[model samples]
Target: MQAWQAGAHPRSAPGLADLPFALGVASGTPSHQGVVLWTRLAVVDPLDPRVHTVRWELAEDEGFQRIVQRGQTETQQALGHAVHVELQGLPADRWFHYRFMVGDAVSPVGRTRTLPAPDSPAGRLRLAFASCQRWEHGYYAAWRHAAAQSLDLVVFLGDYIYEYASPRSGLAPQAATPIHRVHELRRAVSLADYRDRYALHKSDPDLQAAHAACPWLLTWDDHEVENDYAGLQGREGASAEFMAQRAAAYQAFYENMPLPASVLVQGLQGLNQADALRLYQRHAFGRLARFHVLDDRQYRAVQACRNPSESSAGTVRPSRCAELRDPSRSLLGAAQEQWLAQGLAQDSRPGGPRWTVLAQQTLFSPRHYGGASAAAQADEPTPTDPWDGYPGARQRLLHSLQATPPRNTVLIGGDIHQNYVCRVHADPDRPDSPVLASEFCGTSISSHSGATLERAQALQKNNPHVLLANPEQRGYALVELNPQRWQTTLMAVDQPGRADSALRPLARFVVEDGRAGPQRES
Candidate 1:
């Protein structure tokens, strides 16, 4: 923690106008002991250079009559006046209410909870996972619904904010409903641009309510920095300018999110050195579940056989591109892959977590988007941005799962703006291969998908492993886990453009203990 000095506060400074907490508050990265509390001081001028002291208090009750913890922290213009208070040595598996104060202004009270003790026999865990919430596409109705779910944790898969200039700038056409909002900048490139963009997204009341509901565990996808970005490379390829832009985006992301101070320090050091941010992490919910939150965009190799003419992912037949099958290519990079394998192996051991949850970005199962049959589609032109493009890396991940005991494993992901529920086979190419795990790839919160319901239904015949595919709806996945079984409810909002839209369960499935495929429950 950085030492704070007693100085003239923003409220006391002349000519400086005090503002309410427009960006709101959030908490995340929970452990048995404590969690990371976050808030950014809303100022009249974001570029105000004076360091301001922000005070916070945590209590067992919402009224905060009996405050248990109280402290003060300093924020400055360098970090967008954001404060990350990582508290430790607190009781485990308990709810706490916290709020930040600057002079007479008090931030909204946020509710957060710590994870169960590592050795405790936790009975159940309720979580909701979502992704791809393009602010322009629709209202945050899904988030509002999620806020009412009373989830213990919210696993955000990615694309919390899109980098597109406008709805028209996206690759696909807008949904039937018109865009409800627009981005502040044409495109977020500089630190100020990214900061303003984050501020815009954070201003959503529904999103703020969701953040205040519980602690969030997040791992971002491409749009957080740039669409289809891989490692240090962007859509137009790598350059000094792109690297600097990436650094700014990363810094802004760290400042806005409810992440630990350690991540901020490491991210800054990495930005200065390698233009990267270490985001992949593991969290345990007692011995009931272990979440392996993965970062797929930061260290992945550039998409295979990328077309020089296009500014995004390329589609090519596997037979024509040998690079697509190259074993040297990786999505999680060598180090993260190794770390994942080790964690999965350990979690599969006796006395380890009963359920191993691999929370990542994008669909994991193989899907055929073209050709008449699955066999023919295997050779047809396929997008080089997903798991299909990195067959070798996907195979390695399967091998890692195979090496572990037959524990209850669930793979949850987002991206592609579609809901995909499938049985992850040991080898997707082999129809007779053994089922290794169950997967639930959630639909985007609001991002539009080009594939219609009819098209998604038609593709299911070619992809037998898929149990459910709904591309038209826009919502999230609610997961409930216990020792006996794991349940996932596909929750969709009736209208993405309407703020008061009602949410309904599109589908529900369950995976029994020792089973690897999802069975339709309703």
Candidate 2:
């Protein structure tokens, strides 16, 4: 029972023109004891400055007949009237119903569950991993299907809201479907602008349903703040102006998310700076699995060999640029790398998690986009955004895995708007190197891809480790894990523009208990 109050409550209930719970309810970051409940008050005016009292309740049943706990909290204009209730000390491994109330209005009921006890014997885990949901590209039929899967959790690997606006030109070449929606602003630059963009995205019924369905473990990619932003630097370069914009965007992201208040407190402690928000964390589901949620965009080194005139990331030949081989440049900063190494070491111990899950953004394996010959590949240009750009960092990560290998390591990610099922090797360039893990990179939810089936096939011919690559479909990945095997079903939508699109399995792959690579099942 915690609350923030500026003054005493009003004597009479204040009336509003519409329901305040227009954006809907959500829950996230579940643990053995409890989970986080979230909702934002959507009023008639965006500039409402008054403090409003919001009451919340947790129940053993949906009818509120068996109330377990209840509390009241205050929301104001500063925090965008968003409410986050971090519940703890509750019963573990059970379903609970929750909702919010203000005056006579009540929010919709949401269902959430806690993870099994750490020492308890858990059998299985079911989850869906998705990413890159641009509002303008297509409808959220993929989210609707995900909501119906009865999943235990949803791991969202960033690009939840794109930074683009309406009438986006030069997108027809990559987009397979027509634009179904448009952004409210040309580009989000201020706190208000970012907030409005989040509000617009949260207004979708399918996205809301997906949030309400179960708890989500999330991490962001480039588009949340800006496309191809690295550390304190933007595409244009590091500046005070870009830092201010980053501060605003980070604040907006915190207010709209179902994150705990401690994250915000940590951000403010940096001399009232909002440029950074701690997002990388770890979650455990009993002894069955451990999820290492990583943030790659916030602390990465700038793209190597970038053109000075155009500071944004682009393709470059690694053989021509010596910086591409520099050992100091890292995709994950030194601190984060050390943290991950320690976590990996701990997971290899006895009574540790059976499955080690690395949930992050973008593809992990090396992608060669040039000719088949070694000399031609060395001369061909490759994108500097993914792991291929920072070969030394990739080598270090693979070295850590080889040093302290976890049982049944699995890596899941999304970006580039294409689905790839690959075998992560100790050294991707060497064919004889040992397979360290199995990777499943999902396609975008609504974002477009310029890749074709023929192009994907040709690329796979050059990279034999990639068992499957498909860019023609759009959907999410359904992963089912147990003691014996891990199964992934690639769910694809028939028509992305239609609201009631039918979903089909694009492909299926399975990894056995002791195997390090995924075997194509269909």
lDDT against true structure, model 1: 0.85
Mind giving the per-residue lDDT tens digits that candidate 2 earns over 1-522? 111111112324453336678789999989999899999887655576788899999999999999988999998787788899999998888889899999888998998999999887789999999999988777889999999999999999999888766655424546444676654466877777788778878888899999998999988898877788787764455477777778777877888888897766455435124226778888999999999999888888888987745746888877778888899998988888898999999998988888999998999998776745677677678788898888888899899899999998999999888999999999888767899999999999989887889999988988878998889888999999998999999999899877789999999999999899999995
Worst 10 residues of 2 by lDDT: 1-10
Model 1 bad stretches (over 4 Å): 1-18, 167-177, 234-238, 265-269, 370-375
**Per-residue C-alpha lDDT of model 1 across residues 1-522, encoded as one tens digit per residue:** 011111113553342345547689999999999999999876666676888788999999999998989999988788988999999999999999999988777899999999999998899999999999888778889999999999999999999988867755433444454566664466888888888778778878899999999999998998888888888774454477788888888988899999986765454656734425677889999989999999888788989888755668868888888898899899888999999999989988889888999999988888786744656876888788888788888999999999885488889999999999999988886657999899999999999887888888877877889899989889999999899999999999998978889999999999998888899995
Candidate maximizing lDDT: 1
The lDDT values for all models are 0.85, 0.84
What is candidate 2's TM-score against the reference?
A: 0.94
What is the lDDT, from 0 to 100, of the residue 186 in candidate 1?
68
TM-score (C-alpha) between model 1 and the true structure: 0.94
